[model samples]
Target chain A: MIEVRNLCKHYGARKAVDDISFTVNDGEIVGFLGPNGAGKTTTIRILTCYHPATSGSARVAGFDVLSQSIQVRRHVGYLPETVPLYPEMRVREFLRFRGKLRGLARGERETCIARVTERCWLGEVVDRPISQLSKGYRQRVGLADALLHNPRVLILDEPTVGLDPTQIRETRSLIRELTRDHTVILSSHILPEVEATCGRIVIINRGRVVASGTPQELRSRRGDGAVHAEVRAPVEEALQAVRELANGAKVTADAADGWTRLRVEATGDLREPIYRLSTQRGWTLRELRRDAGSLEDFFVRIVAEAQMQAPQ
Target chain B: MRATVAIMQRELLSMFCTPIGYVVIAGFLLILGVLVILTEGFEPGQPATLRNAFGLMPFILAFVVPAIAMRALSEEYRSGTIEGMMTAPISDAQLVLGKFLGSAAFYAVMLGTSLVYPILMQVYGSPDWGAVLSTYIGLLLIGLFFLSVSIFTSSFSSNQIIAWITASVVLASFAVGGFLLVRHVGGFWRQLIQRANVMGRFEESALGLFTTGSVVCFGALAGLFLFLTIKVVESRRWR
Candidate 1:
């Protein structure tokens, strides 16, 4: 539903987004992951047609963002980081205004407003002024406004910034449900929300894409395949036995309360060798687990590697 | 066109939902009432006309119109609503025209309420209906011209107070400074200043002299400023 090719945006001497390219398929929820100032918002703004790219091109829903912006805008719904809303307007009135601006007919606007209000769970405050609502409610209203026209693409920037735990969970579930129909591109710094809601992840740093894949694929590709084991035995004996069993593996061991834990960073499976060593020594093996990298770990490693490769 | 109308409706609704619109209109009427009715000495037996009322409108409008228009785009920028509007499907021209018309409609209401002055004149004495109509036309033209200037300045700054000050300085420079400069200069400079002075064009209609030259001048200036406002808004996409 969205494609960007070598998109470059420069504000004077600084490049906000530089030579970044990505494609999102229909009905796919792509999580845009980046730390602050990683050009995530800048890329989304260009795709939404709010700003022009200094070089290269982007298209949303098959409409060129530069030349055919109006059509692109018509097919895409955007919710900016600040949730741009007029506080004086009631929730229903604001939705109606957005609907009319999107070129919906009077009857269609009425029905769409009702539908979105219900979908976003904004029925209780539909008649009240938006300024009187809480931050979570306002965020929902912003989401409701984006869904009012039922566009083919929904682009949200930091959708769960200020919400409480429950609201964040609700927003995550809502976004997950939206993947059934709409193609969503959302940027957020919260890794867990992206892990819980998005089907795929694209991590960018310093105006470039550092990694892009499914969470599992990324974890496997970047993971070091480390093994961790806990044994109830003499600390020095257990450590010496495991180190000898796993040849040429970096091992670190700690002991407390008649128990010792060992962490082995190895290129291959060390669990079987360690288990055999424990059985031979008559040591009680309490736990043995292989570590698959987490999204947070992957994100941090990718971003750190990018920073190291970046020119000073 | 439908998009323009929707934006205009939203703008107008937002303006009235706040206290600013009502306060501006009420203050304008109260000041005009005091200046034209109570302070300007008129004998009981003398013929009554709206000359005093029309004479004082330009000076008041120079400040008041900008106050009404200062928030048009500045508030949008301050609240980040401009991002939403720009990302919508509407064209920059449509957005500019929508905001201009919304503010213009509010100004019209303010002017409409002042018609009671002429109605009182008609009841107490015989006033020239032609002059009254022409004076109103001239006032509307001036209001539009000032509003265009205000909108341009508003687009340049996100701070409402800064927008108001910039607009006031620009309008006052043209309306008052031109006449002041004309007094010190001679020959071509004097004629140039007189021709460009907005106050002189406004006074021509108030004195029952409705010339095509003045109408075209006001129309052209208003169009120029509005066009400039649109350009500023369009240029924002690059920045």
Candidate 2:
């Protein structure tokens, strides 16, 4: 479990992470979604105790990041954005080293090393130096290192950044599998990656959390609720009928090739009522659709809005 | 703690696994031998003593110790492995101590190889065993002080070359400055230089005095630098 309350981190005048709060329950995979330089990594660093928050507080597994950082670190495993590895250390040797730092006894360290090595699919290159491994394998090594201690909470910042499509899928499944025993907080700009794997999504922009919800909840409940209806009817008549159906919501009409394309910003799902009205009007319906915006729309909208709010 | 030992072992492992460890050892021995031969401490008709060779240690170590410790924390910062290291449920003191001890252990190995020269003195002439022991003890102490200084500089940046240059410059001041500057000034400045300068303290040890004051000086200096390194590591997380 993790809880962040009104956390703020500033670099001189620049606020890297503004006042933001979000909670993640045990065994839940929460995706921290944001574009470049949107404070996603900054927030993760605070949670992992790599950097202290400028203000407020964060707790992981009931331990404060500031006071009980060592305990917080023990409960959580982090795969940093860079995924740095010692170029000279062999894969197995690196894991063994990580295990030691995690305070595993000799026998337990060896067992955990083998288990993580096998789990992360680092079998072939176990004896090879890290410098020789490809990007995908390096990412796997980072993953394997994080899982070496069998930490209760896993924080991965862009876990699949350099991986090819297959590797990405494998990593997604790997993260999903980890939810059985670990609470995962995955941060990434990739829409589908978060959409596919995370149980809940927290969208941040310009050091602020813009929206937070499940994928389906986010898709269903946002952004103008615009319904598009193309009917071969007179503009004035259809506009009047749609305005009546839409009630107080905004309505716009565009006539093209004897068909009036009506866009009604309905307060709720008005597809059923709009269909009946279109039938009653005896207008030939060419296209009738309600826009259920994707997470991509939400992501782009938040970024664009944040950029406008803070301009050079 | 286990974390500290693990980090220390890894640092030592890194040195031996790469050519850096062997190169540093060989390079130090070559330089020390060259300096001794050039000073003509081994020529005939002169008193056979390792004092001249021992006296040049601070100057040699002004370069050698930095080379050994330049990559301690700077490389980790550059490669972004500091994140991995700092997040490992270990304290800053553990990280700094681990690195310091690792470099010190490597220095011990480097110093260990040169011990044969002292033994060689045993074969040829009746070298003052007191001065030899005192000089070696001083060398070990001053070596750690130089290492601590280098490790401290290494914490300031991600560039190992920059760390090496910074540490070398600071140490070369202490190594070359005391002998060069002490005689020019009198009174408090002279006492200060003699007290602060590693070579000045080594001169006392080489005279077979083996003063405890010099041990305290080097020990306190090494401890101060190690403390500063821990603070620097903590400072990054704070501000």
Candidate 3:
């Protein structure tokens, strides 16, 4: 469980993490979605107590990150962006070192290392030096280090950043499995990955929380029954006919490669009306499909537009 | 405290795990051994003493310790591993002291190898065993001070090259005290500058004087640098 309120980190006049706040319930997997320099890492750093918040409070597992950082650190395992690893250390040794730092006893340290090694699929490379491991294995080694102590909460920054597709999927599944027991908060710029992995998302733009909800909830709320249609007709003629026929429907139109494309936002589904109109007008309806509202679409529409306006 | 020990142990293992430790130790011993032998050949009646061995170490440490300590905290910053280490359940003081002690312990081992010089002298001629032992104590203290300085410099920059250069400059300033450049200064200014002679303190201690002042001076120098290193590391988290 984690709580953050009015968290702001300012480097002189620039606000790396402006007024951002969110909470995660026990056993919940929350994705922190943002673009580059969107203060996702700054917010995570504050929660992990790696940096003091300029003016805010963050609590982890009922312990205040500022006043009780040691306790908070005891409960949370953080895998920072770039995966901080000592190159000369072996995977097993690194995990054991992390276990001890988390205050596990000798036998417990070994047991924890073994458990995480198996869980994160690091057994084969356990004896290999970190420098010798590939990017995916090194990333897993970082994950194993974080999971070694069996902490109640996991904060991972870009957990699957550079992994191959297979490794990414495996890590996503591993993260999903982690939620069966521990609270998870991970930051990523990959929208589909977050949608596939996280139960809820806190979308940040320009160092501020612009939207927060489940993936479907955000998609549906931002939706107004919009559909993208590609008609095989003269661009102006197609636009004129659609605009005149659909009386009150709003359309954002564009043409590419001689195909007339229009994004129509209607109060209700207009597939049947558009199909009838195309038939009557002898217009070839090349593609007429309801736009599948995805997290990527929702994210780009909201945060990207917001950033363009404010320049923060 | 436990976390600090964990970090210290890992660092110790890492030093030996790589060739960094072996190279520094081997290079130091070989050069110091040859220096001792060269001095014996040059001044046959001057009596072989660790004074010559310890005398050259400040120059050796000017480079060797920097190589060892350049990556202490700098590598963590460069690789972004400091985030993991700092966010662990340990206080800044513990991390600082643990790293300081770990590197100091390595320096101790490096200094330990030079004991062969004193032992060789004792076998060949009658050297002052007290002075020889005292000189070694002085060298260890100087090594610790240099290690602390290098570590502190390492904390200031993520680039190892920058850390090494900064540490070299700081150590050189201290090592080049009263003798080298002070003659260029006025009498009063020269005396003031002489007080900056860190190695001069070792010279007194090596004379078998056992002055509490010299020990205190080296202790304070190490303490100051260690404190500065901690402050630099802590500042990075907030900014």
Docking class of 3: medium
Off-target runs (Cα >4 Å) in candidate 2 are: A223-291, A310-312, B119-130
DockQ of each: 0.85, 0.73, 0.68
Specify the highest-lDDT model's number: 2
Candidate 2, residues A182-241: lDDT per residue as tens digits? 999999999999999999999999899988999988877656668999999999999998
lDDT of 1: 0.89
| Number of clashing residue pairs, candidate 2 | 0
Each model's lDDT: 0.89, 0.91, 0.84
| Model 1, runs deviating above 4 Å | A267-281, B38-42, B181-195
Task: List TM-score per model, in order.
Answer: 0.94, 0.89, 0.87
**Candidate 1 global Cα RMSD:** 2.2
Ranking by DockQ: 1, 2, 3
Residues B1-239, model 2: lDDT tens digits? 88888888899999999999999999999999898888777777768787887787888899989999999999999899999988998889999999999999999889999988878877877777878888888889889999999999999999989999999999998788888998899999988887888887878887787888999999999999999999998998776
Model 3, C-alpha of A121: deviation from truth (Å): 0.6
Per-residue alpha-carbon lDDT of candidate 3 for residues A1-312, written as tens digits (9 for 90 to 100): 788889899989988888888888999999999988899998998889998989988889999999999999999888988898889988878888887777899998888888888999887899999999999999998888888878899999999999999999999999999999899999999999899999999999888999999988987877656777888778777778778767878887788887788888764677788888889888888888886556677788897688678953
TM-scores for chain B, listed for all candidates: 0.94, 0.94, 0.90
Per-residue accuracy of model 1 over B1-239 as CA lDDT, tens digit each: 88899888887887799998888888888889888765452447665667776777887788788888898899999999998999999999999999999899888988999898788777777888999998999899889999999999999999999998899888888888877898899999888778778899998988888889887888888899999999999998899
Candidate 3 at A284: error in angstroms? 16
Which candidate, 2 or 3, would have the higher TM-score against the true structure? 2
Candidate 3 error regions (>4 Å): A226-292, B41-48, B179-197
